[model samples]
Target: MTTTGATKKVLVLFSGGQDSTTCLALALDRYDEVETIGFDYKQRHAVELGQREILRQALTRDFPAWRGRLGFDHLVRIEALAEMSQSAMTHDIEITLNEQGLPNTFVPGRNLLFLTFAAALAYRRGLTYIVAGMCETDYSGYPDCRDDAIKAMQIALNLGMEARFVMETPLMRLDKAATWRLAETLGGQKLVELIVEATHTCYLGDRRVRHDWGYGCGACPACELRAKGWREFKASPSA
Candidate 1:
């Protein structure tokens, strides 16, 4: 919590993606002084930029209470990562929509790197809360997105920074379907659907199919997972 007695100054690790967009909404609802942090991180394309900008505009335009809490940043370039091999994101390799599951689109150390940056930013701001959108149930099986990985990262951040930093993963236990439901409750069904339309999550870089759940190549693991979740969510009562 902050010393201002306004609860804590929470920083969200936002990416302008579907999950992160929802997390941003959740943070605004739960925190008194919520500040979102979206990074460039040298993604597959400018999709991150597009999504971040849309969310930034949407938050200030739609949510009057959170008008000034939206913050964004860009990383001009990333070094020493090109030779690290392709993961469908930075390469031409076929993104697995495979039946065996687990896709190669999993970028190495992605969550860990993002969380580390988020922790550093929160620590500098004297805040203890960092929000992230990670779910084990409906994901590409990125091992770092799990609860155990987050717990371990929390410990490391505490030890490294000498400050008790709490990484908040509200979507950790919920599947993609449940995520949509939460977004609807936090904001509204229409607003959540707006998020899906604006955010980006295409590993194959397909910006054509703009659904109410983010962009999709309609074939990769990410698109498949998101599409399937939405189908199930639309059918479920809680949706």
Candidate 2:
């Protein structure tokens, strides 16, 4: 899982949420050099950008040996995209089922744009791998989170860039419970605790309320799924 080139570097599309933080831990474990990038797309949960920095600093402090191995943390500001889309995530709208039966939280082409930007950053930095945390198992009906969509985007990105770029989705098939297990496997229980306490995932963007699963508004779709996963994982014999 190590990088192929001499730099041994990879770019991670990190949002400082549960899944992407786990992806960051995975990247650090596999690559000699890992740089994380976050987007400030004017989402409702803009607090995630702050969480990203917190996790970045925590990783450096907790894993001192990985100080040099962990590279830059880029927070790209693209608020124009938020202006162009209407979603519960980026817009102050009601959370309800759309006409397509999808949740209003599904931001159109968010992952696609995120991955594309990550690829560009990786290309500029002489890195070939772009790691993301998009998962089909717990995608919550986001079309862009599907494995087929990722494969197609990978092909298109490689073709457009005219470079052999690897788009790695480590959690593409993992459910929330399995993702919790992965966090433990990557950095043990401390990492799990960090994710639960520091990551932001509420569609309502409320962090004041804390739960066993994490901090969120508790009633949002994101919170419900996360809580359900945590409960299931904790009840399991392995957990």
How far out, in Å, is residue 136 in model 2? Answer: 0.6
In each prediction, how many residue pairs overlap at the backbone (N, C-alpha, C within less than 3 A)?
A: 3, 0
lDDT, model 1: 0.74
Residue 104 error, candidate 1, Å: 1.2
Model 1, residue 66: C-alpha shift (Å): 2.8
lDDT of each: 0.74, 0.87
Q: After superposition, how far is residue 125 of candidate 1 from its true place, in Å?
A: 1.8
* lDDT of residue 231 for candidate 1: 81
Candidate 1 lDDT, tens digit per residue, 1-239? 22356565788877777788888887776676666676554557457666786677887788787676655443323433434746666767765643446566677777787788788778777778988888887787888889999999999999998998878888988888888788888787766767677877776667977665567777777777788878878898876
Off by over 4 Å in 1: 1-6, 71-79, 97-101, 211-214
lDDT of 1 at 133: 89
My TM-score estimates for the predictions, one after another, are 0.88, 0.96
